[model samples]
Target: MLYQNFSKTPVLAAAATSLLLLLLLSSTAHAEAPMAANEATEVVISASRIEMARESSGSAITVLDSDYLEQNQVQVVSDVLRDVPGVAVSRTGGAGAPTQVRIRGAEANQTLVLIDGIEVNDVASGSEFNFAHLMNLEVERIEVLRGAQSALWGSDAMGGVINIVTKRGKGSLNGKITVEGGSYDTHQETLAINAGTDDYHYALSGTLLNTNGISAASEERGNREKDGYKNATINLKSGIDLLDNLSMDLVVRHVKSDVDTDSFLGGVGAVDSDDNTETEQTSGKVSAKLDLLDEQWHHRLSFSANDTDNTFFTAGTESYNSQGYKQKYEYQTDLFLYSSLTNSDDLEHRFTFAAEHEEEEFYNKGFSTIDRDMDVSGYVVEYGANIDDRYYATVAGRRDINSLFQNANTYRLTFAGWVTDSVRLHTSKGKGIKNPTLFELFGSTPDYTGNADLRPEENSTWDVGTEYHFNALDGYVDLTYFHTDVTNLITGSGQTSVNMPSDAKIKGVELSLVLRPSDNTRLNSSYTYTDSNDGNGNELVRRPEHVASINGSYLFSNDQTRLTTGVQYNGKQDDIEYDANWNTSTVTLSDYTLVNVALTHQLNKHIELFGRVDNLLNEEYEEVLTYGTKGINGMVGITITGSL
Candidate 1:
């Protein structure tokens, strides 16, 4: 009966299709090159917490520039990540059913999300950030690190890291405004403004979104509801020139969102939900970078705090509230020299040292949930040296102490060599760990209990890779193979336990290529093959066996108009089987492929028109076995800008 209650909606579909057709018909098409110029050979900055050439490291990393974000007309940060290799994004129930992102077989808590060099992962839930309510209008670029980095960032670096850089002031006061509407009564709006002066610079942005829930299941009528969500963000950054060589910068950011949904367990109907949840957050950080020490030495000091308060009530029932908060502090120093040991062969050396501390607390009322409080402190030391521009090596070590764990030690070794001007090879190995969060130790409902005796998960990983860059043609390709083994996995039964036989392993390969033929058209493609399993040979839930994506865009050399299309494939997965109400069952999740298309036209100097189509085939699929995903959808938007 649950699967037999699917509903059909066509008006929204028709509007989305019409908008796409009109935009495409009005634009001129062009041929795409095998790769994009400069894109394929671009170096990433997130891998080592600093800028470095892609081929100069053993790890795998991906870069997403602003052009890709604009062509897709995406309003949320999560939407922009769909094309990353080995990364999967899923949304359940509706726009706010709690989104989840998995990378390379790692669980949600294993991955780390950074916004402008700041960690955004929730310590209470020990979960990767959903980014469901984060607006993309403020993003300048995105860098993804695809391997373990615990030696540098401490726990939660086992899965990898995604760093988002915010837009900065360039030459003038730049800003834009975007508004969009589509099916399921979805709508979005965003605004950004930035400016700079000889002595001061700053940028500010805000965004809002609303949508009606789609069908939760094939035939469920009432399961499909509506969500009214609001997100507000304010960022202020300023820099002051103190002396000829010294400057200071201050950054402050605050974000908050509210989500409303229907409760399926409280009632059975086609258009109502009795359950409600609201999540709100306020976070801010201040950092200062000092270059006055010397031309070769730099110093940075920063402090940040994040406070989250969440509440849940069933069917107009009031009596429960939950809260979570985290505070972090960091200091770093770096020394760069053109010639360290000697001035011969144009050799160079760099050294870095950093210290950090964090405090996290969780509290809940009106339910059987455990309250958690933790304090963590860590330090890192690293050194890198390059000789004759042909050989390089890096060594790093870290030590972390937490209230829950005595001390965790990690280390990394990296080597790179250039056999030829066009080819390079690299290798790296590192140790990492993921610590337990508050929710895992003490969250409760009618069916679950917390485990307080859990230990941190530990892992060691190694990666090898090669890159060939034909800079002459602005083309490049890279391939990497990685393996990770984890132990002391934490799980719940009557209580939490640290078990070695419960460990897991993951092996994977990644390939990325980019080409630019004539400077106006660009093509980028990536593919991943992964095998992940537990000691008992059970497949990890929610992870696809393989993933592939290709994105192509065309624009007139003048950069006035552009069109883009992409395709993604998520392989089939084994379902989760467990005892629910004394019965056990299994469900096989079907694999699915999706296509997306988008077009943008610069209609003069002050306005732009854009449209996009999602799930082109109207395919129905689930991200979490029996969970739900949105069906075919489309949206049309307009952006306006002004300069003074």
Candidate 2:
């Protein structure tokens, strides 16, 4: 039933036209050549909890820099993740609606998210982070590492890791202010300031957003009510040098939001109602670092805490509330075991050791009062070696002791080597474990129950990939194949949760290309094919079988103006449908494509004008079964930059 009418002719034609125009305009332009394999030295931090050369790491990682984020001009963080190779994003409705991100067909909670080194997952809501309230106002960089990573991170790392690093102050005092307004009576304002010197640095940023959104239910179904949302966020980052060899850093963030929601009926799905949700999130982290022995030995100690409160209202009265609190303490050390440099060869060996303790508490108040808490202690060790800058290997192991579940031990191995001057091969194998969330073990509601006997899910994954660098084309191509097998799959049986009797399997292929055809033009494209099956040989819900995207940018007019365009395609997928009696059955969602364009012009050194059109094609689509999506819409704004 799926893919019967799927067509790619329209999207391919559009992409071809755009590329032709780019080539025609850049025929005579001259620019510096792209960096070669040996000359490139980008560092990735999330793969090993420390900075390592991207070319030497075996893990698949996608790094989005500040420039890329600025060019996209997206307000929500999840919008940017859609361009990553293995990520899938689903939003129930418009902006501020509940959103979920899955990597490689894994469950939403299986992915680990980190912001400024702090874990912000909600312990009371199945240990998953909601992307509805996560804005991209102060992000400097994002690192997406895909694969099983429990050997490095304790839990919730079966799918992958998304690490976001915020901007830090540097140089003289500088700041920026922005204001924008768009369709659906939407408006946003942002302010940021930063100042730093050799010994001290700090940055502060804030954003406010308000939108009169569309209906959460499908408009075709005759829903006419307009839901609204409002959000405010503030962030601060600072660091100070206590001594020549010691330093300390601090990070704090606060977010408050309120969003109107709709009710869900058994047969009718989403229906208009005077329902809403209010959420407050606060998180902070402090860390100290010390270096000795000619800066070869490093040690760090850190403490982090996160608190979240959510209140759900029915009609005009508050019906339920939940709170989640988490605290973590950790210490880690890195040592250089050996190092040697020669004209012909360079070699190095390193070791890392870490210990962590974490505590979580969940509380819910409604018809039934529930309170639960859990603690975990973990230790990890890793060794890495690089031979002649062409061969790399890493081995790691971890031991975790849980207060409510069985103890777990995990391990990982990776290797990367250059097979030729223009080709490189990389592979990794790892094991991961995710403990049952507090809510799944003790939570109780009118429609659902919890089972304390549920077991933790376990996964084993492996991936092999190769990279080819084209010197003549000034581009690179990457292809990878990945597979994962998961045992002890957790699912809901009637009203309570239970472990599946069979195992789940997932396999996928990813291909990506990047080309700097000209100094003034850049192009990027990616395609993914996924085949996922549940224990009972049924396709997983919301996991599309095929996805593709193409994005390009062109700069002209004395390098003062830029034009960018992008297109994304999502193939047909399955979703669960409920009848009047709450019986569930599978339904297929039609495939759709979306087009977007953005432009920016620099008026001067201090003032800039920017605008973007989303859903330019105005194609009707649905990411979720009954969720409504916005049509063609556009927004325009101005930015002012100056020194404080």
Give the whole-model CA lDDT for all candidates, comma-separated.
0.70, 0.84
Query: Over 4 Å off in model 2, which ranges?
Result: 1-40, 339-343, 472-474, 493-495
The ten-residue window of minimal lDDT in model 1 covers 1-10
Per-residue alpha-carbon lDDT of model 2 for 462-527, expressed as tens digits?
999999988776777899999999998887665578888899999999898887778888888888
The regions of model 1 sitting more than 4 angstroms off are 1-43, 216-222, 262-272, 292-294, 340-344, 445-447, 491-500, 556-559, 582-586
TM-scores for the candidates: 0.87, 0.92
> Model 1: how far is 482 from its true place, Å?
0.9
Cα RMSD to the true fold for all candidates: 13.4, 12.5
TM-score between candidate 2 and the true structure:
0.92
The residue-by-residue lDDT of candidate 1 on 325-401, one tens digit each, is 77776766655555435556755666677777777787766455557687777878888776766787889898888
| Each candidate's clash count | 14, 0
